[model samples]
Target: MILLDAGTTYAKILNTETNEKTVKKVAELEKTFKADIGTGHNINRFAKQSVNEIIALSYAGKRLIKEKSFTLLDVGSRDAKYVIFENGNFIHSDWNTECGAFTGQAIEILGSYLNLNYNAIEPQKEFITATCGLLGMGHVFDMVASSVEPGIAAARLIKGVCMSMYRFARKPHKIYLTGGLVNNALFVKSMPVETICLDRFTLLEGVLEYAASKKDDINL
Candidate 1:
C-alpha cells in the first residue's frame, strides 16, 4: 500500500510496502510512485482517493493513543486545529487563526526574532498581550527596544499564544499535541494540561486506514 500527503508547501509520500517515505515540493507530481490512498489539501490533484485532514487526524489519533476521549491539538504552519474525540469518534473539530494566535509560523518567526534556542524557556513573569503574529512581532520589537531581554520577550509571546489556544479550545482537561510544534519545549510549557506528542506520521496512518476502507468497499 502507498499513501500520499499532498500538502501546500510539500508533499509527503510513503510506500507502506517498503516503509519508504520521501518529502518533496508540491509541484513534483511526476508519477514518482503509485499510491493506494491520497490525502491533504492537494490530494484531489493526483491521489486516487482523497481524505480530509481532520478525518485523517482523528482516525490516526484513535489508533495510536489509548485514550478514548481527548482533545487533539494540531499546531500547523499557518493555523491551529483541534478535534475532540470520544470513543474513537470525532466529536468536534475546529481551526482558528484568530488574532494570529495558535499558529506555528508565528511562533517560529517570533523565536527567530528573539533568538530563542530551547524547546521551552525558563519560568518568567513576562507575558505578551498581542496574539496576532504580526502584532505580536511588533510588540516584541518594542519590548526589546525598551530593554526587555530577548529571551523574555520570546517566552512571553509564546505563552500568550498558548493562552489563546487554551481559552479558545474551552480549556480542555486532556490534550494530544501534534503537528510541527509537537517537539517544541516552549509549546509544551504553554499548555495547561499534559500532552502526548505523536509522530508526524499520525495523519498518514489515518490515510492508510481510509485506503483500506475504500478497498473493502469495492472488494478489491
Candidate 2:
C-alpha cells in the first residue's frame, strides 16, 4: 500500500511494503497522478491531488490502515493543526484561525533573513514576546540589527509556536509532528513531551497504514 501526505509546500509518499518514504514537490506528482491540476499554486494543487490519490487507491482494492487512537500534528506554512484519530480514522481537528508570528511562513522568512537554520534555533534561553506574526518579525529584525545572534532569535520563534500548540492540545498523548518545519532540531527538542518527527512521510504512512488495516472490513 502507498500513503500520501500532501501539505502546502511539499508532498510525502510512503511505500508501506518497504517502509520507505519519498518527498517531492507536489507539482511533480501531478503529472503522473493526472488529477485536477488546480491553479499553479503548489499547495492547493498538491492537496487536491493527494486527496484524489487516496480515494483512487482505496477504490483499487488496497487495504489502508486508518487508526483513530493517534493524534496528528501538522505545522505548515499557513497554519498549525491538531488532529485526533480513532480506529484508523480521523475524528476531529483544530487549527489556528488568524495568521500570527508563530506560523511556519513567518519562521522560514525570518530565519532566512537572519541566516539561521531552523534546527539551530535554541528555545530554552530566548524569550519571544510578540503576539502576532508581523510583530514577531519586526521584533526579530530589531534584535538582528542590534547584534543578537540569529540562532537565539530562531529559538525564541520556535518556542512561541510550540507554546501555542501546547495550549491547543488538551489530552496527553504521543504527538506526531509533520511538515517541512519538523526538520528543525531546536523546535523538536522544545516539544514538552517526546515528539515523533516523521519528517515528511508521517501522513503518508498513516494513510497507508490505515488503508491496509481496513482491507478486510471495507473490501479495499
lDDT of each: 0.72, 0.58
For every model shown, what is its TM-score relative to the native structure? 0.81, 0.67
Tens digits of per-residue lDDT, candidate 1, 78-181, equal 66778887876778888774546535667777777567884646734556767577787788788889998887777777777777777766688877887667
Model 1: what TM-score? Answer: 0.81
- Minimum summed lDDT over a 10-residue window in model 1 is located at 211-220
Output the number of the lDDT-best candidate. 1
Instruction: List where candidate 2 sits over 4 angstroms from the true fold.
Output: 1-3, 15-20, 27-70, 85-92, 129-134, 171-174, 209-220
Estimate the Cα RMSD of every predicted model relative to the unseen true structure: 3.2, 5.9
Extract clashing residue pairs from model 1.
Answer: 99-132, 119-185, 119-186, 120-186
List the lowest-lDDT window of 10 residues for candidate 2.
Answer: 56-65
Q: What is the lDDT of candidate 1?
A: 0.72
